[model samples]
Target chain A: MEKSTNIIDCTIRDGGLVNNWDFSVEFVQDLYEGLSAAGVEYMEIGYKNSARLLNATEPNPWRFLDDHFLKEIIPEKKFTKLSALVDIGRVDPNDVLPREESVLDMIRVACYIREVDKGLELVQMFHDLGYETSLNIMALSSVPEHQLIEAFDMVKKSPVDVVYIVDSFGSLDPKDIEHQVNKFKDMLPNKQLGIHTHNNMQLAFANTLTAMRNGVTFLDSSVYGMGRAAGNCNTELLVSYIQKASYEMKPVLGVIEKHMLEMREKWEWGYIIPYMISGVLNEHPRVAMAYRASDERDNFVDFYEKVTSPESTIAPASK
Target chain B: MEKSTNIIDCTIRDGGLVNNWDFSVEFVQDLYEGLSAAGVEYMEIGYKNSARLLNATEPNPWRFLDDHFLKEIIPEKKFTKLSALVDIGRVDPNDVLPREESVLDMIRVACYIREVDKGLELVQMFHDLGYETSLNIMALSSVPEHQLIEAFDMVKKSPVDVVYIVDSFGSLDPKDIEHQVNKFKDMLPNKQLGIHTHNNMQLAFANTLTAMRNGVTFLDSSVYGMGRAAGNCNTELLVSYIQKASYEMKPVLGVIEKHMLEMREKWEWGYIIPYMISGVLNEHPRVAMAYRASDERDNFVDFYEKVTSPESTIAPASK
Candidate 1:
């Protein structure tokens, strides 16, 4: 087996979006301890996107992690470094403090195709501030090949350590992942490639494995398939499946047993009728999400009529 | 879109294993009512495999589906027809009454590569006896290419109405399924093709979709991902996802709301750690099943140690 692969746990980050970041501090602390024991490399605590930007009135502890709040939750840093995500234009540069004072080791920047330059600007700032940084370009399935090339050219010149292939739509197959990996390796030979996948097509786990086999380094997974739409690949799946001798499985199991099971019960994601249909039809999950959240979701006849109607294809332009 | 693809609901047959076939007559009746409302073409009510052959002492009525019990449970045929599965030799020919008198419209035969002839023998008997028969060759993943070729030659000559690509291991990817579909179509050009996949690798939904898109007519799925091992492709997912205007979503949702939610609480099968691990490693779920069954399974470290040891790989010498 190859050397231990770096696992990035995204339960609190991606999963938080499912439940509007309602995770208790106790759950977060227990998750930290469990993930650390499982030998997870990095645990993405939550998005660092400013709550003011989204205009969300919800308690924003996880939405914007503060050094004071983090120190209280986790006093000791042993295994499992902490990470936070920032979207372009959403994060306030003033919110980021000295790296030594904060509990985080990495600050990930998520952006769109046209925002690569802005994303790298944050990466550069985080790099100078003494934090491990990565630039994740979202909605990769829809991005033209040349846009990625143009983006990667700038990313190659940046000080970022990791570049991710984010299958935001969960539309990529294994072959697509391999092609992306090869493209990333050829373009930026010096930087490591990470993969973030959704299970819309039920290919998240397989796609992640394909990337690992083809030499991609970082794997993003959640526990109990708890994330947006069909969810990300399960972290418990990765730790136990990698052939390395030192790959510990208990931490992952502990995370699932303690936090994930309950979290799944409370939240509705992964393998629902709409999500599965979206995956199978190779369409986006928006329609499925709409149908699921609708009152007549269980009424198949009505659901079918609405979906097949000419108006179903022509969604309202306002949203 | 293709004049309504036929759906075979295996909730009772496959899901029965997860709950030790403890389904009450009322639950089966409700499921039948629900499946019928959802426009399911056929519902496999039970398996006719002899319990004595497996030395299973459990009172698994579905394991050995008697005609009297079948009549008692689903007395009236509704919108969907009924079917039952039988293994070669284990199924008593005398046990199967004529289709006119019986509740079952079809009787399927499942066997290994070596038992194709036996499987077809049963298929011919059932066909002559006025039952829609299907030959389901199990473990298509393990079957060598040439063996499948030879088997298909005889199968093409048989009177069976349907041929199934039984992904018993859930190991095949879409490419594999596509290749298999092309091979099946080329070999048995006259027979209708069916797909039955496990969610061991989380590809059940995708694989089924691929088959449907590539011209296979029969699609087998269950409500709420309830089936053997990691479960089958979710029927709700299929109904909601299929682009066909005739596919209804409400009956599936009703099944989920009424039965599946409660069933999920009682039985643990969906996306658990062991199942996800099996999926990521591209391995069979035997270890996961063993681990889940054991009391010490939560100790992932110990389970990892036991499975990866060199001694575990050695096959025992036998006379």
Candidate 2:
């Protein structure tokens, strides 16, 4: 059966957090080719964040994607279309060329609940510029119901083609995912829904499948789950699991064998104790990720104590 | 909420598959104490498979547990109860001491669909011996509908305290788990249901949670998912995620830190590509396990081709 599901590969974008967008041109090319051969619909090549605003001294092609650079890399595009993610205020409108002028087909705007209006503004700009647009609301687990309702009021009027429920904390189970998807569907009637998941507590694949089962169209995945903290859903798992006959697992496995296996050995990602603790506690993985970088990384009992202590429970200064 | 759920840790029993039941006495003791402090209901210590039948030269304590040895290991019983699994034709009935004489509380009988009659006979023997019993129907994904119906008809009449739906292949999703739970519940209303899951697709926790939501009581897990290929659901995840208020996660984390971390380095388990491929294909992990041990272990593309190709997929001589 042909489903409306469009897999969006986020290897270079979300996975940038692990390597600071240090993906080699060769690896990215291989990933693009593999995903295309596997019949994946779109690939979020990288962030469209501007270098001037971010004060980036580095010349990372993936961090600040240039149309000319992207065309040079993947000169001949295949079945997989291109997309790029942008954080609020990080990406300048001037940097993103109109869709027909660039290799990218979509420009996704990611934001917290408070920045929904700002996200929609970017989405509107992208939509008007002849590109598909999506507004990803991160940390849905922490957002208040009233806040979501208020955000949806603006979102419902936005020209965004897709709206995503991001499991930023990687805390949600399938039941929670079902509830969120239903809420998203109810709030955004005409819009397609997408799911972006983290693998803490090993629920990423399950949560993504739940969203798909609930009619979520755009499923976000990274090669071998190469993203931030516990990482995102595995692109290979999705390709193998999704019932759509067009989707092939062999090509995904090909890239995993040819590139990701070596990359995984060098990079730190996937299920780890601290990340699992944060997810189970429904807290952000920032503290856990920091702890993992420290010398006491394997001291999970100590880490658990430190996180669960009364002092760590206090609200941040921003609150 | 005080739910009727009982978590059974199969760390040593199922994890034995990884290292051939070579757990140190000290580690087993530590696991028992940790699980007890964490308020886990039961710990499956090891298999009761007779060494005489298997012709074992090795004195693997966990594989062939002795009543006297168990008493010496856990001299004082804590909150956590003890259990051991037995396979049909492998365990000598005479080796099982009466519940009143032995430290073990439960004796679970695991068998295939074709061997349910034999499984129940063992269950009846255990029941007569004053031991709490369970019938674990393994490789449920391979079993036909009529086979399950036949097995359940025998299972429904058995003097068993729990009946488990064992996803021996790690092939099921949450929806499949829910459906199976419903089927078990409808067929055997009087019998308590247990769930034993593997993490091949990282759906173990989600599937176990789904079963719990549907009122299945007995939940099987292993410390850091230390069972066979892809392993069982993480015991810490369940200890942290289950909101029963009393299932303390600190002790679980303590054990994982104190022992499992080093053990994980020595043995191979948890989500690997081959295990995941087998799970996605709904096949047993034996071939995948063999592939993982070969020189070309990381050659996932070759493995995918070999498994998916027409020649390798043909039935064995038995079939």
DockQ winner:
2
**Taking the tens digit of each residue's C-alpha lDDT, what string does model 1 give over A165-272?**
898878777778889899889999999889999997577887888788888888999876788878998777677667666567776666676666667777887766
Ten residues in a row with the worst lDDT in model 1 chain B?
Answer: B310-319
Residue B285, candidate 2: alpha-carbon lDDT: 88
Cα lDDT of model 2 by residue, B119-221, tens digit: 9999999999999999999999888899899888888887899999999989999999999999999999999999999999989999999999998999999
The candidates' DockQ values read: 0.25, 0.89
Please tell me which predicted candidate would have the highest lDDT against the true structure.
2
Candidate 1 chain A: 10-residue stretch with minimal lDDT: A310-319
- Overall local distance difference test of candidate 2: 0.91
The regions of model 2 sitting more than 4 angstroms off are: A313-319, B313-319
Q: Docking quality tier of candidate 2? A: high
- Screening candidate 2 with a backbone cut-off below 3 angstroms (N, C-alpha, C), the clashing residue pairs are none
Q: What is the C-alpha lDDT of each candidate?
A: 0.81, 0.91
